[model samples]
Target: MEGEHSHKPADIKARLAAGPKASYLRDWVYGGIDGTVTTFAVVAGAIGAEFSTQVLLVLGAANLFADGFSMAAANYTATRAEREDYRRLLEQERRHIRFFPDGERQEIRQIFQNKGFQGEELETLVSLITERKDVWIDTMLAEEYGRSNTQSDPVRSAGATFAAFGLCGALPLAPFVLSIPEAPSAATGLTALVFFAIGSVRSRFSTRSWLRCGLETFAIGLTAAGVAFLAGDLLTRLF
Candidate 1:
């Protein structure tokens, strides 16, 4: 009776471990917020200075491409360097595990002991973990050195950032791009929408609700724009 209902294939019955979640939320949010903020800052600045729509388009487009690409490239390099550092540290941990295993065993015992294991249970767990070299290595990397097994994808991260940067960052220029009348006012409204949208996307990764995050992002963006706009007005008036 226990075996009679078993119909699943062997591979189907066993679930494999999936790849770790990519650590790109920071890059995504940063790129998204920064891209849009900088582009909008330029637009607001141009508007304050009473520049023609042609001047707004020229400045906004230049800041959009130049700044967005630069941020994406920087994220890629920084993320790649982080992965390389992790790899190097992992190799060092492996060597330590190999050459000084007794020391590592003591360290493992201490780690679990700190977790409240004692007597037979502590010894048993240490034995079970060290039985597999990979598990042992992972334990040392996590327990002793405070690291995780996830490998970051720099190219993927960079692409996400760049895509966000390009899509949302260029929003402020949309009115001018389309040659809409009263372009500055329309662009401000559009900028608010863009801020809320990016913030909603950001909520998926963080614990914050979409509404709170959206409002907060919107506020920060508008504040930045106001400052930029004010600075432009001051400079224009002074000159």
Candidate 2:
């Protein structure tokens, strides 16, 4: 299979030793998309209002840092909360196993029984699983609470978000900072490119083709920027 690895014993042993790879793809994609969309929205609005280049640069830069940090901090807090929640549940499971071993065993048996294990097989399976305290607790956590075996690193997750946000967000302000000719159009073009690029990167984790993902993200970002531009134009005309 395309994504499958060799099932040879040695290969399996090495793979297991390496452990599960933690993915920060979601954090990066979230940050990248938001950064491009929001920064470009600011640019579009400023352009619609006929703001000076200096004003556009100021606003765009402010959004890049302020919004990026806010997003990173939020991500950190959320990831940490999830870890804490997992730990709390883990301890609770430990306590349950300690004080109510028989009940916990019944839970394990019922859980597997629902999966169709019966007779000696179920008894043997439960015995094998319960022999190890860590495995026993983990199985209960996974079966009862649907918790993942791997937890994310909050600091790493937040770092990924902040880095992606800053990198993608900077694209919109590039033209202005460089004093490019027709900087507004340049900013729009560049920001659109960033949106498409982010989507292309995102497609690696999905079933969709890169081009389709890129176009989809491009359209969404363009729509958001268009709305911002129109809003600014409407407000300008009214006031």
Candidate 3:
């Protein structure tokens, strides 16, 4: 039982047992990291360019709304595209099974045979699965095509992505918007925290250490900000 591999903590165990649904947090991490990075990039760039707080506010706010919505729209379209691809493949499988029953059966048998099943067991499995239309199509879809039932909900995914983007993206602009002193520094700190939080939250769906994940995300975001800031500074000096 110790090495059985299914064992997990009580709270997270149920979710993990459920498969890819738990992995939907990918959208959350994706949106959060980008939102913070882009917004902070603007803030850092404005500062490095010796731009006024007003300019920082304007740029950051503009990025937060425009870029956030764009990313969400892209996510929605991409998710829908994936679903459509799956449907297309499933339909193809259906037609294949209908038109060429023997060939389809052979395909199933060959698949299982390659997996080490043969003779009685192989025939039994092939017969059992192919006996039902849905089972047969699903088996081909999964085994042959590597598809799964855990299709992402486009609406939910887009909502999660945009919500995370909006919240995390607001960090860099918060200081300037709120008239905080040392606005640039405040924005940097806030964005860093957001980055760490996004990484930490991502760990919930992965086996990675919370601290390590948090630091990795922080490093990526800060590095991007640093580059943007340096570019702005270089451009400012040149022009």
Candidate 4:
């Protein structure tokens, strides 16, 4: 019975350690949407300027590659920096334990007291937590470290984000790349349809209604297209 009881906390900790896949998926979806929206607007604007198809394609391709790499690199560097900061904080905490044991114990006592454990129970809990080096450190981490489970692999997160964004960005422009000489309008219509579908699909990440997601995405895409088209037309007039 004692053994079984002791294992319960370990089991709970194991369950807590499990990664939240939905959160990662949501991040990827958002990244993709951002990339797609920005790129689509730029491409549409360029096309509206009555530039040759070659020029539009070149611009779109450049945007896709540059933006994807930039997002990925930024994610990688940021995650790595955060991880390093966390380690450094942990090391400082360990040093505090070595050099200021009394102060650390007092802090732990206060922490437990604040949690409603008082008198002997609080003393026992504090003693148990401080008895082991690992347990002691973990308590300090929870109470002081303020660390939470987040994406730890900078490279993996970067790769996933870049791939998701690049794929989404390429979808609308694909029609332009594949268009035959006689069917430009058809290609544009097809691209719009794809944009709507991507938006609807992305809504799943937000756990929102498909209709709302679709409409929101449509609004964004339409707004970008409208603004770019007007700008392009204005530029043509000026030049």
Candidate 5:
């Protein structure tokens, strides 16, 4: 049974016009998980080294801003590189279409023919696709180069990463900042919660169950903290 008016011509036309939206889910999740893990790792290390609350706060704060900004900048550069590459490829395709329409049309024909179109049907499909320059270029980008139509804004992607990193990273430093007793334990607990929360939120974009995602992220975070703690403890003993 059809639900609502989803199958209506008007609805289909509107949806197609809107096209696919660029997603920043990966940026947010990447920044959030790394922030929690790295901050907690710092906390664990400081605690193992028998550092004072003031020292822990100083270290955690430094890591939060420095690392977050670094990650954001790197993401921005990478996204800009992708956009540049797409533009270069787009221009290249446009030139090829302009200078060599026959070869381009043949490429289109071969592409669809490989997909099981045959004879008059394949010719019809090629004709339909090649009639419009925009559609023709889009088809070539998607089928030949595996490019996505939606282009994500580098600024937005970087902003999302930095925001998530700062927000989640702050959790592990909160207790020490506020001068709470048992600050290390508080930091650990808060960081653990953030890890699980980030993972659960990420599951909205994936097929995985929230529980599995949460537990997976929680384990990875704790493991990183554990390693840092061990290293700090060893160094303190050795020195």
Candidate 6:
């Protein structure tokens, strides 16, 4: 029984460590979608307003840089804060164990009991977990607080978020470069086609059926573009 329990933590640790790469990818992709959607809407609105190409370019560039950096900074700060909070909680748990061993032990038993453990089995499990200081801290973190000791580098996450967002945001503005003197309609059509394709590709990451996800994303992009267009038209009328 002890051996069986001993093996479980290792399995849990392994499971926890695995798949973070894919998780990171999904985060990056989703963040990119957010950035892209907003920028696309802004650019579309500007185009609909019949703003000078120069003004549109400036707005798009500003949106890309500002939104990307802002998102990255926000992510960095949030992740760092969460890590600090986790550390504080862990230290508090350690102090409780040190100063009130009996109380803490009883709390651990209660935690296990809440999970439906009872009798000698619960006692054995609590004893096993609380015997080691690290394990004890981990158990409290998991059971009492629902926290994990997983370390995520805020700087890395922020950088990835920025890069993903910037790359995606740049896609919608690509048409502006070609809008030169000869063909604005062609440029707009091309931009719409490209954005739709991107929406479809992004949909593959979600759990929804590909067709459904693709359509939803496509509609969202179109709706954003249409709103911007209408807003631009209204502004043109008003001012």
Whose TM-score is higher: candidate 1's or candidate 4's?
1
Pairs clashing within candidate 4: none
Instruction: Return whichever of 3 and 4 wins on lDDT.
Output: 3
What is the alpha-carbon lDDT of model 4 when measured against the actual structure? Answer: 0.73
- Give per-residue CA lDDT, model 5, range 134-178, as digits (tens): 999999999999997689999999999999999999998998888
lDDT of 1 by residue, 1-239 (tens): 43233446754455333434757777777888788878888887787788888887889888878888888899889989988888998899789888999998999999999999999999999999998989998998888768787867989888888988888888889888888898878888988898888788788767889999899998987787677778777887898
Sort by TM-score, best first: what order? 2, 5, 3, 1, 6, 4
Candidate 6 lDDT over residue span 1-239, tens digit each: 42232358888788666734323554475567666766776776776677887898899889889988898899889889988999999999989999999999999999989999999999999999889999999889988889887757888888888987887777667766765454445545544554566556766565566667666766766676667667766877788
State the lDDT of candidate 2 residue by residue for 1-239, as single tens digits: 78669999999999999999889999998899888888888887787788898898899889989999999999999999999999999999999999999999999999999999999999999999999999999999999999877999999999999999999988988988999998888988998898899889888888999999999988887787777778777887888
Alpha-carbon TM-score of each model against the true structure:
0.86, 0.90, 0.87, 0.71, 0.90, 0.76
How displaced is residue 94 in candidate 6, in Å? 1.0
Worst 10 residues of 2 by lDDT: 224-233
State residue 231's C-alpha deviation in candidate 5, in Å.
Answer: 4.2
- Candidate 6's clash total is 0
Candidate 1 vs. true structure, TM-score: 0.86
Q: Which stretches of candidate 5 lie over 4 Å from their true place?
A: 1-11, 231-239
User: In candidate 3, what are the lDDT values of residues 131-223, reduced to their tens digit?
Assistant: 999999989999998998679988888888999899989978988988988877788899889888878877765678889889989898888
Candidate 3's displacement at residue 133, Å, is 1.3
Q: Per-residue lDDT of 37-151 in model 4, one digit per residue for the tens?
A: 6567666667657678788788878888898888889877987897788777778878999999889999999998998999999999988888887778768877876764343
